[model samples]
Target: MRITAENFIKHLKKNREEALQYVIDEYIGIVKAIIYNALKSYNDPQIIEECISDTFLGAYENAKQFKGDKEDFRKWICTIAKYKAITKQRKLSKAPFFYEIDETGNAVKSAEDEYLIKSSTEELLMMMSQLEQLDRDIFTMKYFLNMKNEEIAEHCGLTKAAINNRLYRGKKRLQQIHLGGSMS
Candidate 1:
């Protein structure tokens, strides 16, 4: 039998393997795009692929609880992909850094490089802490997760204009903090 959006949930409940395969074939591109955008800072294909697999696993496991048609399924899977990638990114950020040796026997990621990256990220987070929670969330979603204003607004239950305004204001505040030499 040919599987389609209308019958996807039914298939998922009845034959998970087939439904999963169908979902993989149909929505892999969307999932990959969302995951890639979320984990772009990593620049690691293996991590991205792992997050993709986790997303499909999550969707498959939660299929029984899902409702709505194909469009909703697309959105749902995209959300799964995004959150999974973000979770992985957080774990990686907290994990220890691994270094490689170059052909000339120099560490690819030197101590200075590691210190700069770590300090910069720490400094940015410290600066972000000065903003209101909503503004910080908007900035994280927009810059770190690569979400569009519409997506951020939807997630935050605000209008796109409001999201844009918050982002603008947030940047100005962070700029002031940065310029004032308040970051230590």
Candidate 2:
């Protein structure tokens, strides 16, 4: 059968098994590519596969909520794949790995450094969670992705000044949260 998303949606609406299989067959490449781009820096095959699996599972389980052009399915799936990758990134990166594995598989970091790294990361993520969603994304891209202000600005289509303002305000909010005080 032809593999347009419209055909897939019809089969999905009917709860046919082919819808899932067909959607995976037709879209896994693009989905995997989107996920891979998000995960390329880590190079962990297991996490990548899990994110991809979760993406498809999300699509299948929530198929009824998808309403748009069949041709636009690729974009929708890519967005899902990106968020799946982000969730996996959060799980894998909740704490910074202060230690590098040595040649014989021993960690090369001091205990103090590990504690500081974990504690700082936990506090940082907690503070980030309190920011507005767009600010959170910008902060993550800046610090987590190691993107420069120019790159984040370009990717987000905002001016460099706006990106700087977001970073400044985000850091201010982080301090406020850490101090156990409200942003007044």
Candidate 3:
């Protein structure tokens, strides 16, 4: 039977197993597509899975909000996935581990910790535009795409360990140029 939002909601309201499965089957790909696009620069597999789970959880919790419209449902779920991706991206970007290192070798205020992170987002983008193609690809896959290391390895034809190494080195280089003196 064709799944309509009205029918889906009816079954959902009843808490029927078929209703839940139908929702999953119909919308999981949509959620994944939204998340994958938003996180195309990221390479952590779990983040994608987390976003996917959160997408469904949001849908389930907000089932009552699902108007009997397919487009509306897709938009609602995609919105949730986008928000989740942005939140996750902000959290990753603000990691203290990537904070600036002082001449004394101590971690100073984080490169990502200041108001500039929010304000200088465009600058960050500009810097990314300056990276080599391969570096940009790995960086995008790791941070933007949010794929797993294994997934990136398969996509890029490298070992997971090699992907990790490249990501590590590439990020370090970005930090050095962007967060180091004169850039931030």
Candidate 4:
């Protein structure tokens, strides 16, 4: 049967399995696409998967608040996915490290390392902002959401190969710009 927001809400209110399943089955592709596009820049796929799961769980918990059209739902999900991706990125950047100073009056822990990381973080954010909206979306989904190319393709109405191509080119461009700016 076809599922609408009204029906979905009814299922959610009643805590029906079918409704939850309907949402999962129908919207998983869309959710995956939203997630993957929002997280494409992250190098760790595991973190992206966790964030994607968190995004879906958040949607499930807050499904009752979805009081808009289907398109609005899509946008809302995408927004949540993007926010989750950014949060994860911030977490990665803030990851702690231990350093020890060796002998010879040389400092093993240097201030330059900190500055380089800080600068790279800023450069990444700046380069992300410079990307086209569509490219940003694709990047987020692939990297932050940990989605496979086929799923993104289905959700975005593109072929699997096309999604792969877009992701490849987008990543190459982002890396070039970000690294090049930092080096310069």
Worst 10 residues of 4 by lDDT: 92-101
Tens digits of per-residue lDDT for model 2 on 100-178? 7788875566687646544554455456557776786686567544589999999889999999998998889888899
For candidate 3, write residues 91-178 as lDDT tens digits.
Answer: 6666556666677875466454554643454345446545655666666666655678899899888899988888887777778778
Top candidate when judged by lDDT against the true structure: 1
Error of 3 at 149 (Å): 36
Across 51-161, the per-residue lDDT of candidate 1 in tens digits comes to: 899888877876765665676567656656766776677657654555565778644656775566545544665576577667866776786567899999899899999
Model 4, 66-133: lDDT tens per residue? 55555545655665566666665665555444345466643354587656644554455447556655
Error of 4 at 85 (Å): 1.1
By summed lDDT, which 10 consecutive residues of candidate 3 come out lowest? Answer: 117-126
- Report the candidate with higher lDDT, 1 versus 2: 1
Q: Compute the lDDT for candidate 2.
A: 0.72
lDDT scores for all predictions? Answer: 0.74, 0.72, 0.66, 0.63
Off by over 4 Å in 3: 1-6, 14-17, 97-184
Question: Which numbered prediction scores highest in TM-score against the true structure?
Answer: 1
Q: Candidate 4 has what TM-score?
A: 0.45
